[model samples]
Target: MSTSTLDLAASLRAWGVIRTPLVRLREIEPSGVAIYAKCEWQQPTGSVKDRVAAAMVARAVADGALPPGARLVEASSGNTGIALARLAVMTGHPFTVVVPENVTAERIQLLTAFGAEVVFSPAEEGSNGAVRLAERLAADEGWVLLHQYENPANVDAHAVTTGPEIVEELERVDAFVACLGTGGTLMGVGRALRDVWPEVRVVAAEPPVGETIAGLRTLADGYVPPIFDPTALDGRLLVRLGDALAMLRRLVRTEGLPVGPSSGAAVHAALRVAERLPAGSVVVTVLPDGLERYLSTRVLELDAEEAGGLTLW
Candidate 1:
């Protein structure tokens, strides 16, 4: 369906967007230290990528790079594709998402439910495989690719919106922790925080090299997102899968926060940062998404022997 520029604006207005909340974790923080979590799951698609998707599509349309009703293609493990799929439907454009076969079953179902075409790349190659496949498809078929890994719009979205929200809510941020995925959140929010308070430390919670954690990536994994700058980070901590999963359970049981694995990793890193800081320090982190999409992954489940659950807490 060919859509005119006039109709594009109308289509865009039909969807409701939101400014997600920033909640301070006073109850869960150590004495004299404060930690906050920006709740991105409150977005339209229940993920932070909602901001990225909206920004990318709107900018494409405004810049005339994306003609009305042009098909958009992307590679994602889940959240970005889900956000793009919802936006594609809203903006009267069809979208195609290429994902690795190992992505959670819920994500595939969510993409299908959004009426977007889903293609599976090899699981062994992970997101890079999906990227390779998407690049080929976009080149061969003339589909416009919204390459989130390299898109300036992804960074701009967080800088213009998310960054200000944090600075507005908190008096001062001593450290900002975020997982390293496409690096948009880390780079954009880090820059904004540093611009406001030059001493704000930007820390990264990365999965161990050669280890797998959904929605987070290690730099040594062969594909570094173009937007990522190692120099911007004041510190980098390696989160093991076991530790991340353990934190996920702890957060759920103790704080009543059922966030995904990457969020857990960020929280773990944030806590460590808080421990070393002097009293009255503030640290902010991001909770990217909720547990709904990740239930199918065993990270949230117990083994048959421990099916009754960990009772010793």
Candidate 2:
């Protein structure tokens, strides 16, 4: 390897933009329960998916699967697409993102703004439809598909970096909670924590079926991700849309964290698990992204009737 390339690879590990802060949320729950959140939204691409995107691209290049200036394709709700779009540009690869038609205008605009080719799948089918369409495109044109839903690197990124970061900071984790999308974070982080603490409870926080909560998916949905395994989780918590919205508001006001709906849902489930645990138990949750990606949606603009029924669960 060239001297310059070796230096670049070595310095990449110490890059300041790659690390994010972990916040210990004391006021969000009872005195006995301690809730720690990994604020992944502070990443360079503004989401936890940045880690996955970087890993996938690096592996593809190293394995000679992706040539210089190759074109790439992927299916994402918002965060992953945006992360890949940014990375593709930086790495001199053209990217095409197939997303749900119902996604907020803010996300669509951001993807296009990053110079990514954007395609809209059917709104009724949600993210699953985007996956189908992207798969077809990948097969037809021989495009390099990052396939986050099935990629092992997606899980590995969290297992190596995100999970160890939490274990290092908190020392011990009684319970680990994360929203279920493609199951990368839950599976990767869960396995990492279990390696250290065999009794650590791995919980999944998912939105109720038939709800339009972005960034989350229920297992009841017809298409289960290839990487998802029910046996990996200790339990699953169903979060309602109204309750998630309420928690979003509370988090912004009380904790000063303007997190996304999926994050709010994860926090809600974490608090539920915390309530059942003994005093001084530690619970860690992953906030996948912040509110910047959901500004054009109803995430922060709930009406009176909608807000009234949602009690903090």
The reply for model 2, stretches above 4 Å from the true place, is 1-17, 212-221, 303-313
Tell me the tens digit of each residue's lDDT in model 2 across 195-300: 9999999999986433542433555656778888889999999887767777778888889997887788899899999999998789999888888777755558
Point out where model 1 deviates above 4 Å: 1-15, 212-221, 302-313
> Poorest 10 consecutive residues of model 1 by lDDT?
304-313
Model 2 TM-score, 2 decimals: 0.89
Candidate 2's displacement at residue 128, Å, is: 0.6
TM-score against native, each model: 0.88, 0.89
lDDT of 2 at 143: 91
Measured on C-alpha atoms, candidate 2 has an lDDT of: 0.80
Q: Show pairs that collide, candidate 2.
A: none
Q: How many clashing residue pairs, candidate 1?
A: 0
RMSD each, Å: 5.5, 4.7
